[model samples]
Target chain A: MVTYVAIGLLAILASIKAFHYYYQIKRAPSQKQLSKLVLSTLRRGQSDRE
Target chain B: MIKKIAVTLKPYNRVPFVYQKLKICRNCRHFTVLGERDCMSCGKTGGLQPVEKRAAGIVRRDQWLTGLILLLLIVIGLLFSASALQTVLLIAAGAAAAALLWTLSKRFTPALRRIQLQKMFQQYSYELASGLAIDHQAAIRVFQEGDKPRTYEMLREIGSLVHNDQLKLEQIMLLQTFQLRKDMDLMLEPLLMDSFSPDLVAYIGEMAKIRRDLIKENTFRYMLQHEMYILNMPNGETVLAAVAGAAVRKSRYMTMYPYLLIRYARLLPKDRFLRLYKFAKSARSGPLYDEVMRIYEEKFKWDPDFQNA
Candidate 1:
């Protein structure tokens, strides 16, 4: 009886974890913006060196 | 004469997209939060521009990567489970749990972004301090892109390390563009001058007017010691009035501004004179106060209520 209860609790926890990732990817801005951010940082670094 | 460097610099080159989502309507001047296509107030679409970032933040990559890896691990764990109805149900539950963890972790995104921006700023500050020259353009870009308080903090950091007058003048020029806080003014107190370039003096004068609370007593003393030549520029009187007002509020030593007050006593505006009058009246009666009072009386005819007392 105890073992069955433990298994049920574990299952519930895993479901919660998977749903969290889905939300993050959904909320994230487009890949293009992310790439732009990276490019700008690189450009700034180069300019600072010069 | 401090000449303006004519560099055709793009103001928004280093600004990120997330920072540009908000705009002010040109037609109505209403602040629009989300819709960029049309002004929510007047429906004028063309005049919208990115004005300011509402929050200090950056995209937190590490947390995102961690959540992804955790989800991937859960998927692999479920794939190895046996093919029974109970096993399938357990796998479904596992997926759900992983999803919750991932999404809940994202709630930390804003907090993480703040921390990351701070860390990045600190690193950059150290770099600027150790370098041979002050990077005015880089500082301007940071001021434009970073959070308001942090930008001032970075300025303070750079300001402390900078010793050259030309660089100091540049820093002051950069500083004037922002709406500065009192604490930032305090940080810039060490840069106060008995004499400076007319342009720099004008800039400092503007700062004194806008952020009066930030000026230290020593700055007032510096002003008192310097000859009146510093105030001969276009906005010199405005600067003097600002300094006098700030000195009245900040100077604890009673004897400090007496000479200045006496010299410029009659020239002071009614409000400023009243402020000085009130401060002098409240202070302990000493020879210095008496002398100051004598000077005030010399400038303006007034009968004191406390003369009989």
Candidate 2:
């Protein structure tokens, strides 16, 4: 009974870890916006230089 | 006459994305492209990490926590197991699960890291911009202090991530103050601007004389786009000839700008024309090749350099 309980816990923990990684990867935001965000933010500094 | 200082600026680290050059403070979340070891805002030692590395660190810590939890649970189960067979079975199960978790995490580490990077940028967009702004101000203050080289260096670091015409202009203006030379580490591409500034044309002329290798398509395009304006400036034709001489350094350039060579071929010095002669000697007949031949026949028919070739 103890053996079965430990086995079940291990399987569940592994499944949870796998799911966490998969979900994190699947839900990744589009990287396209990232470049624009950085460039636009930096370009804003033109006001300071002027 | 002012002395020309041999200023050799440092090379920037190559990164896949410009933002990767930015470091965020762990304590203050401030962004900086400067090379200080500590966070400028929080004054905390060892608190700064490149944003990408910081994101990777967060992902790695989470992975470690999961691994620890799995290890702890496995240990607890082993200590409480009643029979040897049960213990053995539990050990095998835990090992299999741990391996599976490890494999999955390892396989998706890069994807996980990208997500973390995006999250950091999204969460702290304002901070990133403000941090770069702070760096710009600091550079300005340095400029106020009359440390032109240091200020240019600082601006260069910031410019890697914060590219704009203003930054390029600042760098160019500072460069104009300095007497440029061949030995100094200079760059051309980063300083090219959309608008025609006489200062930029002057810089291009100097680059042509000392570091002609740096001249490429964009530099050619920029120079040609403002040819009339450039010619309006004194010694503009001389500058164009130097650039043509630079174009002669590469066959690809000759192929791309045969018309340019044709215009400036007569102006190229004997040394440059000789190089053109050697290159044209092997190249299949083309307009540039014909022009080089024409220049040779017109000017160098009796020249010793052509005689040797």
Candidate 3:
């Protein structure tokens, strides 16, 4: 019975961790996307200044 | 590299004298006037640096909440489990997983970038402050050469070190050289002087109208005590007009504005006082408005528009 309870708690914790990992994956922009956005913005700013 | 060029451009390498002027009150971030060692706002000892911006409270709140929830889960596990050793092991594994996930999420958060930028700013400001302390001319060169944001940071640190009106005034003049689109009003607050030059008075008046909320009590006090000097400036009346308008718009400045106007009433010309009286009446009717009316009556022998209103 003790072993069963421990397994249940671990399952719950793992589910929570899995959900969090999914959220992180969805929200965070990839490095390539960020760099491209930055470079484009910089180019536009320089052109505007000139 | 810019810093190197700036030093080479200095004329005499004279200790700019202005860099060592004012101290920032760490508690309230108020700039104490020269010769004063204590902050008037919080009565704290003046320091060389004001507190920098910190990460938002929400980030920290989330961190605490995560820890608390994990602890609560562990506690529940301990209570329900029959074997203490198994429960301990389960709790430890759960805590490790949660902490790992928390660390991973925190690394990707915007707060990470904010912290990184703040660290960069702090290091740059420290070097700028030390360079200015050692050689004033070198600092000026950097100010001229550095981009707007860099110049902004340099001014922020230099503001904490100013000790006199002259230095404060010079700081404003230096700021005028930069045509930054970003609102530089808050950073400029510490450098506001009691006796503004004509142009500075106009700038103050413009800033007062646009960013009235940023005006500190010290500013009103300066206007009150140095009424003669401010009123004599070319833009003195305009400054007073803007200040009066600000007082009417915001209840915060209303406390000082009414008293300041009354004290300066006896000194103001008839037309000027009349203008102030009209401006004060335009705000919502209050005890302050009535008091201002009474002052107007006493000075002018009668309130011209009071009966009509």
Candidate 4:
């Protein structure tokens, strides 16, 4: 019974990870997001020097 | 005649986003935008991979882990199966789930990679910023060592990420030392400043004379806003005329910046005036049309080229 229960839990966790992966793929970043990444990181670099 | 120093400058590697040039150490995960070999932080050789490749590697690892979990569950279920029927059912279910996941990942590979890249950047923003800062310091140290050309090259690489007025000005000041040659790789748009500086205007004028094609709307606009200060310079009219000549290269410029021609039409060299004359002949009567026509009459009335035009 304990072995069966562990199998069930692992199966459920795998499905959950798959679901998260699907959403991550679906909501992939746009051009604006990449541009923001560039601006934000550059801004951080400037502040760091000061 | 003005002399120009000729030097071969390596063309900059172009990218849609500057971050694309970054390489991260797979070992220490330290990021750097410099050369793609050897982790500068850990001194480990051959441990660096391009950021996108690193992101894709992470995606593949996650995918493998998920698949392995499903496989492990099926094996555990089969080991404790009460009947042959239970064993078959567990195998079929696990196989189906693995197939579905493999197909999904294969189809969404590009999207998965892009999403992973965004995540990687967010998670490692601090490391990436520090890496770039270190690159900047290294460049400054080179400058201190009095290798002006080498220092400029280093700054140019770092400028891909660290774009601010100070960096732009430093490049301009260094450029002022070297005689700018038309054949050398020079960039104007990246170095354009938000505010006015005499050094910048002089550079613009220099570019206008040699690389007229680099003179675009931003440059025209810059010159227009600071026309008074430019006029105060001994050769200001000459600079303005050279810029006007660049405008004549495109009909779009003639239509877009008539005011520029109106003010400096007479100062334009003969060839530029001929082009403006041809444009003026087609005008339906804006201030630009009138100015070009008046200049044509006043300056080129008896010239053979004007008569043919």
The numbered model that scores best in DockQ is 2
Name model 2 segments beyond 4 Å from true: A1-6, A23-37, A40-50, B1-3, B75-86, B278-294
Per-residue lDDT tens digits for candidate 3, residues B1-309, read 112112111111122332223344455444322234554445566433422222333346655676676666666667677877777677677767676757665665563433432333333443333333433343455657855444434445444543356546655665455442324434436666655465466556666656766556766666566667788887686677666555544445555567665544445545555555566677747665676677767766555544444
Candidate 1, DockQ score (0 to 1): 0.10
Q: Rank by DockQ, highest first.
A: 2, 4, 1, 3
Model 4 gets an lDDT of 0.80
- lDDT digits (tens) for residues B90-198 of candidate 1: 5565566556655666674554444443343234433322221323444556667844444444444434434345446655665555554444333346466545556
lDDT of 4 by residue, A1-50 (tens): 53456456656765776787787866998745865786687688678768
**Strongest candidate by TM-score:** 4
Q: Score the docking of each candidate (DockQ).
A: 0.10, 0.47, 0.05, 0.47
Tell how far residue B51 is off in model 1, in angstroms: 17
| Winner on TM-score (3 vs 4) | 4
Report the poorest 10 consecutive residues by lDDT, candidate 2 chain A.
Answer: A41-50
Please give the distance, in angstroms, between residue B290's alpha carbon in candidate 4 and its true position after superposition. 2.3
Q: TM-score ranking from best to worst?
A: 4, 2, 1, 3
> Among all windows of ten consecutive residues in candidate 4 chain B, which has the lowest summed lDDT?
B1-10
Task: Tell me how candidate 3 scores on lDDT.
Answer: 0.52
Better of 1 and 2 by DockQ: 2
Task: Report lDDT per candidate.
Answer: 0.50, 0.83, 0.52, 0.80
lDDT of 2 at B224: 83
User: Model 3 misses residue B159 by how many Å?
Assistant: 2.1
